[model samples]
Every structure is written in structure tokens, then in C-alpha cells.
Target chain A: MKNLKYLISLIIGHLTVFKHIFKKPVTLEYPEKKIELNDKFRGEHAFDVEKCTACGTCQRVCPSFGTIEIEKEKDENGKFYPKNYSIDLNKCIFCGNCVQYCPFGAIKMTQNYELADEKKSTLKLEINTLKRNYFDNIIDK
Target chain B: MDYLYFLYLELLHKWNLPDYIAMVTFPIIPFCFVAAALIVVVIFLVLAERKILAFFTQRKGPNRVGPWGLFQTIADAIKLLCKENITPEGTDKFLFTLAPLLAFIPVLVVWGIIPFCNEFDIISFSINSLLFVVIAAIPILGILLAGYASNNKYSLIGSVRSVAQAISYELPLIFVLLSIVVLASSMNLKQIVLAQSSIYPFCGYFVFPAFLGFVVFFACGIAELNRCPFDLPEAESELVSGYNTEYSGMKFAFFFLAEYAMMFIMCAFIATLFLGGFLSPLGFYVGEKLIPNEFLANLSVYFEQAFWVFVKTFFLIFCMIWVRATLPRLKSHQLTAFAWKVLLPLSLLNLLIVCLIKAVL
Candidate 1:
């Protein structure tokens, strides 16, 4: 039995290497090929002024304190709406918690993953400036 | 004395250079080239082995430096170089300094004998076959140098252990080598390779009658290299650096470089010994006969031979890495005793079987 095991091992040893001969060699060569970050990539967050009801739902949903900020404006009708909905995109975890509870798809994730900026403040997401490419791509195709 | 003569002939006589320059600079070039090449090969082998193992393990290996971590070795070299050339003051400074080089140079010289491609041939053959064995015998000296030179307690123990381990494995490895020489009846490696050509067609490799010999040789060769499972000397968690506890800087790197160079050579040696030494496995009889162009046929023949040889060697290397990552290192006595009680006996049986087969055939 030991001899059989040894013989089996000896024969199987060379054969096992063949398993990797055609394997999907897990190497990405990353710099050469950018990662195919999925649409559900859960990346930097964007603000949607047209849709955000300004219920302060997102601010409450944000686990990281000071990640989202809401400004208020009162109309003559005595109704309050968000004057500005801003997110420190740097602090946003892209947890999609805000997305789940968002009654209106006001704040959501964007596809822009390379968010690196020279200035720290460059990462700030102003509702007015937030590009809707994430939503646009979702709808366009 | 001999090397100094090689220095003069190569530098002064051949190049018509000044004796001072020849003596000072010329000898250094081969050494430096060898040293540099060995270092580079070791780094490449380590990266490659890691990457290949990662492939098997389903993960990305060091992929940060210079795209796929090509510069990772450079970073390592820099770090190792800058760290420290610390020698325990009580150590035999000269031998401690020399140990890694001694452990290293044999592996490098083995490459001097191995032919990589048809064009990569580097060995110079001579009358006495003893020279090949004599040069091949240098690694033991290096192992001894490493063991005895370092004055540390563990280094002394590890060196002695390694010497025993190395010498025990050496017997089987040599027997396998001799088995090949018996078949080809030539000590010259080039002749051994030439004999593997498609003259007999199906029998290009010496693996048929010598199959057991080749297998035993490869197994013993791995043990001789002192890799994992067989890595008794530097079995970390026991002996910190084994024989290399006291070595550092370029000396340590030389040892490191030598280890990988030997691994590469061992693969090449296995290829040369069994897989038809640069003879196209497919080119056996048919292609050689049908192809009108001799050069084209021979070129294809060599290319085919080189491919199989490379495949076999790399596969073995991958196996070594797998064993390294999978198994535990053997104890010192178990390491030597296994060689004596198991591999030694098996190799002798293999030798007898091979002889009987030859006699009957």
C-alpha cells in the first residue's frame, strides 16, 4: 500500500502541474489593464438635487458622521426644501445604505473611481455639480 | 594558481591588455558577470516561482513594482544590500565571509556546464572527465565553507548537518549522472545532448531504459539543492539562518543567488539528462528524413527539444514550490537518515534495475 501510494503520488505529481497549464493565471497585469469595476462598484457618491426630497434621510443613513450635510431654505408658503445637498465624497463609504432608503433616487453612486485629487476639497460633492453619468449610463443602455 | 593563469591568458595574451589591467580587471569581469547574472537569475526565479505558485493557489503574487512586480527584486536587493554586513566578532571572519560564495560558486559553475538553448551552450570539454566531476564537487566545499566559516553555535550545527545531508544525497545524484554516461558513454554534456538527437527517432530521451534513473536523479537533485522539506540546514524556527546566520551584504546575496542559479541549473540538468537535450521530441525520425533543408530541420528539431526540456524542468520547479508551500521541513537526522535508509537504498536498487535492463536488452 505504501509503494502503491508512492507510485500513485509519483505519477499524479507530474499530472497535477497540467491542471495549471491552462488555468486563468490569476495575474491581472494591473497597470496594463484597468480593473473592470462593476456598475454596482459602490464607489464615490453623487448628489441628485432634482430627486432628493431633502428629508435628511441620507444624512441619517450615513454611518460616518459629517459625511453628508444638508442646508435648508424656507419658501413663502412656509415649506422647507434643501438649499444645498452636499457630501464629502472622501468620507462616503458607498455602502448603498442611503440608496436603499432613498425614497427618491436623489443621492447615488457614480462610476468615477479614480477620484484622486491634488486638493482635499476637490472630492466634495455639490448637488448642483454632481454629474449624473452614473444614472445616465443606467438609463442610456 | 589555475584561475590566475586563466586570468592572464584571457586578459593579457588574448586581449593584448596590460598585465596590471588584465590581472586586476579582466578576472573580475567573469566573476562580476557571473555574480550579477546569478543574482538576477535568483531574483527572477524567486519572483517566477512565487507568481507560478500564486497561479496554482489562485491569487496575485507581488504585483506592485514596475508592472507585475518586476522591480520587486530590485527593491529587495537594495534593502538587503543596505541593511548590514554584520559579522559576529567571534566568527571566523574570512570563512564566514567566504561561506556564501563557496555555497554559491558551485551552482554557478554547474550553469557553466549546462546548455540552455542550442545557442546557449557554454561548457568547454577536455580529455579528463574527472574535471567535470571535480568542478561539480565545489558546492560541497561551499557548504563546508558556509558551515565551518560561521562561528555561531547554530551555524556550526547547521553546517555539519548540511554537509552530511548534502553528501548523502550527492551519491544518488552522481549515480544517476553515471547512469546517463553509461548510456551515452560520454562525460561531455554536449556529447550527451548530441546523443539525444533523432537518430533512433522514438528514443530521443534517455528516459526509456533510464527512466527510473532520471526520476531518482531529479528527486535526489531536489534534496541536494536543500529546498523545503529537505531544507534542514536553514530550517527556520529552529536555526535562524542556518549556515548563513552570520553572513550579510553581497556575501549573503551571493549565497542567495547561488541557490536559485542551482535550481535553474538543476532543471536544465534534468532536461539535458532525460528529455533529449535539445533534440526535438517530434523530430525523431520522420521530420529529419522528410525535411530537405538541413538547417531548418535541425533548427526546428532543437526548438522542439528546447520546448519539452523547458516544460519538464519548469514543471519540476513548480512541484518543488508546491512541496515548499505544502509540506513541513524535515528534522536534521530524519533528513540524512531518509537519504541513507530510503533514497540511498532506492537509488542502489534503481541502479541494479537499470544495469539488468541494459544487460538483457
Candidate 2:
């Protein structure tokens, strides 16, 4: 009776696995097919230049020291704006602290997670790259 | 083979060539055919396992190499060929070098023992089924030598487990084979197949009478192949790839090639033993009905026989892969216990049943 039960379960297990053959595969062909990300997913940082008063709250609130750098400058309208704002992504741990603690809503995280690069210098996102991330997210939405 | 020799001799006679030339060249044709067939079958079997396993897990398998990853194994073979052959230090150099060849060569001989179709049994002889069992066990020696030469504790342990597994499983395997031999009343594999043929194709299969033997043989075949669920020898978590751990590049490729080739041949052997090998399950040959030209129809029947052999072999292979995908590795003690306690008695019972049936018939 024990052997019979074992044999029945073995057959059941095989039949269960066999049924999976006809069902649709859940794998995405990585390069060709991209997975859908959540709306509030924290990926690469997107900077809104228009909203920034350059108070450098993101630089202070960031958990990793030196992950975010803000260089303040005076524009022709005499308002503070960032001149050489660069985020060293190598140090950034995607903690979302900068996005959470921002006073002026100047920075946000976008769903642009393909941030791998060959060089450390390339990984550091500059003002232009950050601005592009913001625009890209907008276009994505 | 006699037909082939006659045709070759006739062709030589037409050209005023010597009969000795035909004799010399005829043997090479089957050797080349077996070698080519081994490569093709092993490559496709690897791809099939991966594709089928992926399907079982709800994932897309290797679709990047070629259309549906058809060239994936070919590309892998090329990659293995290009890699440097690295022999580690503190190893017995001579035995380490010879081990893979020792493991692989026996499989090539075993492939020839299988009667593929009516006229294509490459190395036919009386007691050829017994010969299959003898030659198949030789790879264990190569594996044991590999572990001994590697100077690695893990490899040694793995090889030791393999020998134990082989010994225990071999009894049930042979007992099942004994039942089959009794039913067929012949030890020659070709004769065994001929014995299975009747007016009703499917009912004529030995699988009907020796169904218990079939199940036992299939399990023993998996254990002999050291496949998944019984794959304690190469248990990745414990042994880090087992007896071939110290081998790399083309040497490692030989071990890999031998394994897949052995799997194909083992499935073919099972198909021959139980499933009415090369016999059309539909009770008639398709070529005889479809083809109008007598000579072409005769030629096509040989190819069709070979086709039926492959179809049955691949179905068995699919079941093996399914078992692999479903089950986890067995505990070492459980493996041996299953063989000795569970399988041994079952196979003996199967033998008794077969003998009684044969007597009654």
C-alpha cells in the first residue's frame, strides 16, 4: 500500500510537470523584450532644473556620502540654480532618500534602470544626463 | 551488411575493380555512419533536453544561437574546442590524460551493438545483448581512474559513490534484461526484435507482457546513466561536478560527449528491448503503401525502419528528461536501497511472470 501510494504520487508529479508544457512561458527575451516596471520604482535619478532652488537638500539627505553633488550658481534672474550638479551613481545605492527628502521636488527617480557602463566616469550622471532622464521618463509615461 | 557487400562487389565488377577493395571500403562506411549519427544525435539530444526542461519550467530556452536555438549545441562544441586544455598540478599525468578517452570509446562501440534497422546492425553477433551490458560497465573504470588521478578528495568521493550505485542498480538491470531475454528466447538483439513482430504491431511488443520489467529497466537505465534524481556522482551542490572536476577544454568535452551519447544509446537499447524496435506501430510500413517503384519502396522500408527506431528512442528520451525535470536528487542511501530492496524483488517477480508466460505460450 505504501509503494502504491508512492507510485501514484510520482505519476501525479510527472503529470503536473507535463501540463506546464502547453501553458504560455513567462520568460522575456531580455534584450528584445523589456519587463514592465512599477510607477514608483526608484531607478536612475531625474533632475528638474526648473524646480531647483539649489538648496542642496538632496546632497545632505543622501545616505551615501558624496553620491550627489550640487554646485550652486546665480543665474541672470539672480535665483540660485545648479551649475555642475553631478550624481556619482557608483556610490548611490538607490535608497530613494534623495527623492524623499527633497524640499523643492527638484529630483525624482525614473524607471530607467539600464545604468550599467564600462567606466566609472560614464556611470557618474552629469546635469545633461539627469535632465535627459527627466524628459525620457515623461516621454515614457 | 551482406546485401551491402553484394552491391559493392557488383559495382566493382562492373568497373573491373578487385573484390578486396570492396571488402576494405565496406567496413569504413558503417564506421563513418555510426560516428556521424552519434554526433548528430548527441547534439540534438542536448538541445532537446534544454528546450524541454525550459518548457517544463515556463521559460524560453536558448533561442539566441540560431532559429529556436538549433545551433546552440554546435556553438557550444566550437567553444569547448577553442578553450585551452588545462591539466592541474599534483595529478597523475598519464592516467588523467587517458581517462576521458577510456570513458568515451566504449560508448562508440556500444552504439554499433544496437540494431538500428533490418540490414544496418553494424556489429551483430549471438549474445550481443549480453555484450551490451559488459561494454556499458567499462565507463565506470574510466571514471574511477579519473577520480584516482585527479588528487582531489571530492572527485574520489564522487567516483566511489558512482561504483556503489552501479553495483546495486546493475542487479535489477540484468534481472530485467533476463526476463526480456526469456520472452524473446534469444540473446541476440536482432533476434529479440524479430521475436516481437506479429500481425498486431502494438500488442506484439514485449512491453505488454513485461511491463514491470520495462519500468524497472527504465529506472536502472537512468541510474546507469547517472542522470538526474540518481545523479549523486555529479551532485553539483556536494561534489562541484564530480570525477571530471579537474578536467577542462576538449578533455572535459569528451566526458560531456560520452554522457549524452550514452544517454541516446541507452534509450535506443530500451526501445529495442521493450518497444518493438524498428517495427511500425501502425501494423504496416508506410513506404510499401506510398511508394510505387519497387526498388525505391524496398530502399525506403530500410529508412522507415530506422525512422521508427529513432521515434521510439526519442520518446523514451523525452520521458527520461521529464523525470529529470520533475525529481530532485536522491539521497545516496535511498538510491542504493531503492535498487536492492525495491527494484531487485520487483525485477525478480517480473522475471517469474515472464518465464511463466513463455512456458504457457
Q: Which candidate is the best by DockQ?
A: 2
- Stretches of model 2 off by over 4 angstroms after superposition: A54-61, A65-86, A97-104, A139-141
Model 2 collision count: 0
Reference-based TM-score of each model: 0.68, 0.93
lDDT of each: 0.71, 0.93
lDDT tens readout by residue for model 2, B1-361: 7887898899889999988898888888898999999999999999999999999999889999989899999999999999999988999999999999999999999999999889999889899999999999999889999999999999999899999999999999999999999999899999999999998767889999999999999999999999999999999999999998999999999999999999999999999999999888998899999999998998899999999999999999999999999999999989999999999999999999999999999
Clashing pairs in 1: B102-B142, B103-B142
- lDDT of model 2, residue B66: 85
Misplaced by over 4 Å in model 1 are A6-10, A88-92, A115-141, B1-91, B107-137, B140-161, B175-199, B202-206, B232-249, B267-338
Q: Count the backbone clashes (under 3 Å) in each candidate.
A: 2, 0
- lDDT tens per residue, model 1, B91-200: 77787766676766666666666654554445546422334456656776776777776767788777777778778888877777777777677887767777767656
DockQ of every candidate structure: 0.20, 0.82
Interface CA RMSD of each prediction in angstroms: 3.6, 0.4
